[model samples]
Target: MLSILKDFLLNLFFILIPIFIVPIWIEEKNIPKHIKRHLLTVCFALVIILCMTIPVDADREFISDLRQIPLWLGSLYKGAATSMFLCLVTIGYRSLFGGTGFFVTVIISLFIMVIGIALEKKFLALSSKHRVLLATALCTFSGILSIVLAQTFHRIPLSSDISLAYLSVQPICMLITCSLKEMIYKNIALRKRIIRAEKMEAVSHLAASISHEIRNPLTAARGFMQLLEQHHLSPEKRKQYVRIAIEELDRAEAIITDYLTFAKPAPESIEKLNVKTEIERVIDLLRPLANMNSVEVKTTLAPFTIIGEREKFRQCLLNIMKNAIEAMPNGGVLQIYVSIEKQHVLIRITDTGIGMTKEQIERLGEPYFTTKGIKGTGLGMMVVYRIIESMNGTIHIKSEIHKGTEVSIYLPLSSNLHDLTNEEKKLFMAL
Candidate 1:
């Protein structure tokens, strides 16, 4: 009797200690995922088998390894494939040792796995608290059902004390282990999320500080350059100097504003904005720059309207088109298309610039991340992302090496106007 309790404690320890260790291995991307799972599965089977042996009854004919914990856990956490693999190993290992009630263990383990897979979809849909409750309940059922199957099918008779131990100790250990494991893993994931948010906040603060320091000087320089243009000597020479000074100052000021937007966005003066009109204005504004690069601008605007501040909406278009134009430093085509779909307005901007790798696209909105050389501070796209998010829109970017890049922005249509049909009003706010 005392041996059974000691063995149960050992079994619980083996089951849980590895829960913490395996996550460490699996989370390390340096290790190939398949290798980690295979290694952990084999390790788990061995540990459970060893744990079951540690508490053999005094009769020496039977081993009371609380080993089923890993079988159920594998199915619940990993998937049907891994748990089934572990099940086969457990059955073969037990049979080799000619264990009593081996067939009973096999039957119960198979039943638990089938149920695990069937429940997996719904199980995952449950909240964390409910999942923990369900896991504990299922594990407890598995432990108890195994004992009943062994007694009924294998005709294994146990003393009342041993039966009580089987009913109480095994189920309780499973319950406690499941609860502890769930709580620990949840806390770890939550801690990671908190750390990521803090890092983004820190970066925003740094950008804000830099923008405040640079804006005044750039504005002063631009004003002085404008005054010098009035005292024209050679008209050509004056025009050239003024152009150079103004371009440099404008670029600097644009970057500064991006940083400011990243740090702290001003309160939006939300109103109905005409998307087609604003986009045409930006296209006209960028025509000079686009011509110098020999890039042709093609537009297919479908007159979509959305709810957002007009100036900010114009800025969004300006930043995107400017990037598209810059992408094609040598002659290429920039296509801007707008359409309505699924009660939403879709804007696609495609540039034949040197395209980006998958890794660069994934880091698109991260601070200081850019494919553009020193000419880009990487804040422009960050502001683009921020504004789109503020307006409840979604953005998707697709690109490949040498194939150019395509950016798609989707925004909900404004519901405020009476011209929109009853069904059409729901299109924008649906996001």
Candidate 2:
């Protein structure tokens, strides 16, 4: 009888040690909650080990003969139950915590397990830390109590068998729980990034709408102010005041025009067109402005096609080119390049002009963000941003104070274009 008791104790150790150690090692890097859940699962697995090995019908003569069943089979059953329980626990924890406080929860759980283990051993006569830890502790103590009662009363303990089975299977359950936690955290982070991008797009659209509505009236007002300047007036006295009024109106109109351009709706006439042609058109349009400032235009065009609205695309090029010309008031080379890659069209615009600081580049395309004073509406880059986004493209800007600036645009070769309705198409045709 002593030998049988020794063998049972040895079997318990062999079953429980790996179940505890393996999960701890596997989850070494995991945060506290994950570790806690995993540890709890290991404990719950101990119940399965207890049910499988403990002689359920020790009073029945035939049942004692069944001890020859392989010990490994019992271990495997314990592992499986632990795995299932861990999965359930992980799901529950994730729902409660939303993936935060993993480390904190794990530490608390470990403390609880330690305390629970000591209590179970003191009051309930369960041996081994594995039996008293996490979920396994509850099952192990309950099983032991049932076993003791059955022996004292000389009665069969049928319920104890089921409890023991569940107790042995904690390890497998914890592993499943940890995996679910990781998946939930990853999904939440991805969703946050998507929401941020959507907000940026909405801001760009609002800026564009405001600019468009205010521009035409501002231009007419400025034109009327210029006409008023032509009226006969006292040569010296009224001349200074009139000139100041005209200049102020001109500045206001320029600001309104810049805002309108930045907020203008993307033209619907997008088509597969040569990027080189677009760049050349922008250079030609900006030549008078550049020559007036003595800035030189240079080009290195590689044959590539991009599908986007012609007018909106033109505006993007024009804004960057105009900024470059204004930067090099004393004359500088404005280099434009168009190149093709496997799935994208790349446009690189570089200028040897007064450059901006890192902070300016970082804040580029933000609405009403500018460095050009009253001459800048801070909407140029914002407009460029909206057009590129509407075309499902990306823009990257790099600059260093007194060095120069380079803006690169990456446009996908195949864009998902929304076909215009009949009325929209007719409006485009009219324009």
Candidate 3:
């Protein structure tokens, strides 16, 4: 019994090593998640096959080797397709060996896959103590039965005491694995959350500093520009100078507004705003700039109602649309679409422009990060992100290097922002 327990611990440790080894090969956010998923699945399968070659000997009979760990984990986390592949591999590997318990291996392997798929969600929700016990119980029964069937049908010699050792050791091994997995993952999650909180704190501080440091000078410059407009010389020259001054001042004001907005929390102003009307107004405001850049602006705006401040919504649309228009230096089509979905309003903006890389997209809402070098203050999109978040809405931006960019925003059709239940709020935030 002592020897069997020791082997069980050793077997499970080796099985888990391949799983934990994935962190070294694939860092979070470094590779696309789907690719990482596939790679990890392959790695876990390889480890399982390797473990299958080394079985625990009980009175010179097979008892345990942690064969079920990969099968069960792959199903629970990697989903059906990967789990099915693992099942096939396990069956094939056992058949290739073809010593004894072949039929029992195939039957129990099939049972594991079936149970894994059926109980994945319920099992995940279980407490660690219960989850480990339940899973371990199933694996233990199948393992002991495999030994029994081997002795009965395949004429392999086995002892009853060895089966008892399998029963005793399997649950202990599973409990240890479960505890370690939960602890490691929880620590990782906590670390990520702490990093995120720190980043947000830094953003708030920077926004405050920028707003206070630059706003007054920008206001003074704008006022001087307004005074100069009164004592004009030539119509064309005055117009050009005034235009340049005002444009520069407006740029300064935009930067100031972006930071100020970030530093402050949004006020509670909930009203039923017409999405189509507000969007049309923004399009009109940007028509001249769009025309100047030779970029065509077209919209398929459906009448949709959402709870938000009208000016805030207008400002949000203006910043986003302006960014879209500017993306097309050589001019391209900027398309806007608004539609009503189940309980929300959907606004999608697509621009045929230079587009952005994956890294640029990931860095979109950072305080000082900018895709456009000198021309961008990086706050336009930052303000856009804040507005959407405060409105209890969500935004998704997809871009390719040269193909183009598409941004989709979803806002719930509620009486007020506070009306959103926790679940609905999560839905929008997840969007």
Candidate 4:
């Protein structure tokens, strides 16, 4: 019995290595849940086949023959059943009770596994996690039950066959369980992120509306004040009043412009354009600013075309580059790289400027979130984020304090213009 147990553990270990390790190491980024499930099933199936085919010798023929069956197979089935049950239970519990208790979940998992075994068919109704837990409970129960039956009967009627059946259910259950758990967690996280984004967008729109209404009158008032300053009045009084009016008008205008940029961003008129050409134009526009700060701008542009609003995209790139330039007022390298991967274009902007802390980066897309004092309104990156999102693109930022920052943008290849009604196109153009 000791030798059998040792062999069973060793076999189980070997079986799991392929199922877990290969997927993680070889296809790290895109490990599909279905592939994982099938892998578990195949691994356990092999173990069962081996057990039935292998020979064993001992005093108790039935026990010895049963020992020859692969333990991993039982483990797989139990795990799969338990996982499926757990998923179903979690969904129902979350809906009805708003949560699930750990112990209650386990109990439900065990019940589902047993039912699946008795039915001898994979229950597709339950989720992967519940299936896994059920499979685990079923296999464990079967193994213990087998031993009890043998001791009571004083013989093994079909110990080997029963053990093989148990083995088949466990591992599959475990695999399904793990997959379900991951899926659930991911979905929850995604939903939370989306909600936060929508809230930020709403705030930005409000800000923009207020800015627009305020700015029109402010512009007219400033023009009238300038006309008054030009009149032949006393030199000292004219200079002082003109200074106050001009300064206040400039300040008010700045506030309104920043607010509008954040709130009511214009939609992009997306077109297929060369990314390199766009970058060059922005570079020319920002060169004087970079020169003023004594910063060196470097670019390695790959020829890639993307369907996007050219002006809005330029503004996004300009905002990021301007931030980089400001960070290194003493001078540093602003490196830009444009590349293409399968079905997507990648833009990476790196700065050798003072980088931000983790906390700062985490709050980057939030409205009015800024590290630059007085001069910064904190809406530059927010605007950039809105533009990128509207284009159906993704952005990732990595930064280490004092080391520097890298921002990567991934845009899909589909440049096909979204179909728009004439009114919609006109509205978009006006914006």
Candidate 5:
């Protein structure tokens, strides 16, 4: 009795462990479906063979083992093809034992295979609780059939203790294993759904950000082209308009390329950026727009070094200064100043324009909330907020209606000064 119970428990572990653990590996998208299916079939076949190799009682002419559990599970959960293969394996293995019970094993396996194949569709369609009940019922029926056939066909004597134990334990083990498999399947399906939803959300955000960024340069280019259409414009002015238009188009292309870097497999390169050089580049690009709005550009820039992506840094500066110029349609002073404050680089951009209300300022970075109304998507400041945060920086805006607005950005100073040449270090010190 002790030995039979030990064998039964060992058999139970074989079926249950893999059912719980293998789903995690097989659920990965990288594994092809046919490969996953083959892997599962091989796993269950091994479990079936292990149960058969160690029979419950080596002395009995008619051996009993819990091999049918995995066979039935594979069939009901998978389909008829797996059922046919498992039935063949069970019969073939039992034939090697050379006993009257081998024929009985053949009959029972075939009967269960037929039943499993027939009811597989309904078994899968059932709820988890119902599936467990049905599987347990089927296992119990197979146990009863084995006992009746053994007695009627060959009058083989059976131990009452072993029979009772098999009847009770087989159904219970089937119930436990089936319930666990159903639970794992439910969780895996839910996880896949959540991952898909998160991917969709990321794509939506990227689309909105790219559209907003590209529109800025395109809008500026359109403005320059409009200026060039004036028939009475001087030759020099037309040439200047065409140059600014070409530069704006190039800026638009660069913005598209920058956004695409997020999709690449490799990490983007980060470098030490000179604040003065990048800021001046942005100012030079936006100079045409500033002149159109009659806004005077004044800068007090220093060559402070910071760590970030250079294009993103330039995009941030361009967005802020463009907004400042647009704020003052009737002409005003756009002042940009850079200095060191504590352990950070401070960039202050103040505009003498129609400033914003406290309410407007609070809503600055909210998506699609704009004082420019139809002309703005409100994503520019949103991008600014994201980039600054990614660089471990902070931005503060102080504005009052009819007064002026001051935008202050604080970025941590790059600490790798050893990379700079002596001349560069001297230039930094002089500034």
Candidate 6:
């Protein structure tokens, strides 16, 4: 009995190794279905050979092992052609050790294969739990049929303990092996579903972002076009409105180009950007808006360097500063400061605007969350967060209601910045 138990465990170990390995291996390699089926057939054939090569001897009159489990599994999964091939392999291999029992093995194997093929479609259509139950039932029936046929044909005398061991162990082995294979297949299917869902969600987000970003400049251009209908306007005023409209249209074009670059499969362009140069450019661009709102712009920018894509970094800064400017509808100060701290270049933008609550602050970068209500699409900060994260940087926000808000951005200092002398760095900072 102990010997039978050990043999059963050994057979199970050999069978399980390939059962678990083949699916993951083939999935990673992106193997085709037809080829994958053949690979499974070959692997299971090897397992069958291992099981047959080392048979469990009970009283020397009975020879048995768990070879039927793999045969049944292959039949149910790989279709009729594969089942036929495995059947041939089993019959051919068993013929080597000729006996009356060989004929019994042949008869029993054919019986199981026929039943398995008949139920293959039904088994596949069943839900996971039902499939496991049905397969287990089939295996148990096959075991019973084998015992009855063996007694009728070979008349091999077997002790009660050995018979009990054979009956109990084989069905249990079948149940376990079938259950594990089913679970693995189920998990693989679930993972594929999750990956597909994530991809669809990303595409939806990209579409929304492109729509939101392009809408602003287009809206601006439309407003200027509406203003151009006036018949009494000065020549210079009319020309200024036309130029601004054209610039707004050009910005819309640039935005579409940026989004196309983002959606492309090619790699993004990264470069070391001078902090002062980029921030000053954005500040200059928004200077007119600041003046229009009676908001004062103050800066203490240093020529610190950080690594990131030029457009994305500029976009991130623009969103942050634009929000700061908009926050102060009643005309307040927007302070920008930059310095190196603990090997990181820190960008601190402070605004004397109507501030936010802790709850609002925590939800800043979440999609469609905004302090500006209907006037905001709420994607700007989300874009800022994603771009900063891509550059391996972090943003920290501090705000108190009716007082002010400060946003601190920390990015790793560029390696080239280390080569600059302290005096040169100071001179650059002063500039």
Best TM-score among the predictions, by candidate number: 6
Q: Write the per-residue lDDT of candidate 1 for residues 170-225, one digit (tens) a residue.
A: 77877777777687778778877998999888777766755754665577667757
Question: Which structure is stronger by lDDT: 2 or 3?
Answer: 3
TM-score versus the correct structure, for each prediction: 0.52, 0.47, 0.50, 0.45, 0.60, 0.61
Model 4, residue 370: distance off in Å is: 1.5
> For residues 368-408, could you state the per-residue lDDT of candidate 5 as single tens digits?
56688756645678667767877889999999888789999
User: How far does residue 201 in candidate 3 sit from its true spot (Å)?
Assistant: 2.9
lDDT of 2 at 392: 85
* Arranged by TM-score, best first: 6, 5, 1, 3, 2, 4
In candidate 2, residue 318 scores what lDDT?
A: 94
Candidate 2 lDDT over residue span 61-169, tens digit each? 1121111111212222234343334334433442343323233223323333344434533433422233324333333343344334433444444455433442342
| C-alpha lDDT values of all predictions | 0.76, 0.57, 0.75, 0.61, 0.83, 0.83
The alpha-carbon lDDT assigned to residue 184 of candidate 5 equals: 93
Error of 1 at 299 (Å): 62
lDDT of 2 at 173: 32
Error of 6 at 340 (Å): 29
| Candidate 4 lDDT by residue in tens digits, 1-431 | 55555554454454445445544543445558676656655554454344333423223222222221223233234454533533343334323322222233234335444454554445334565665565455555655554444444444444455444434433444344345434554565577699899989886776675566457557756765766757576778666767777765776665565565555555546687677788899999999999999889899885566777887788889989889889887889999997755556788999988999999999997666778875665667988898888778899999988878999998875432245336434433543
State how far residue 371 of model 2 sits from its true place (Å): 2.1
Worst 10 residues of 4 by lDDT: 61-70
Task: Report the Cα lDDT for residue 273, model 2.
Answer: 69
Pairing residues by index, what is the TM-score of model 2? 0.47
Residue lDDT tens for model 3, 353-408: 88999899999987767877867787778888999998999999999877789999
Alpha carbon lDDT of residue 22, candidate 2? 48
Residues 1-431, model 6: lDDT tens digits: 68778988998998898789999999899999889989999988888888888976633334688888898888887778778888888888887877777777798779867876788688788888887787788888887777777787768444555566778888888889888998899899999999999989978987887688789889999998888899998889899999999988887786565455444442289998999999999999999989988899999877777888888888889989999999999999999999887678899999999999999999998765779975665667877887888888999999999888999999998865457668537754554
Candidate 1 worst ten-residue window by lDDT? 55-64
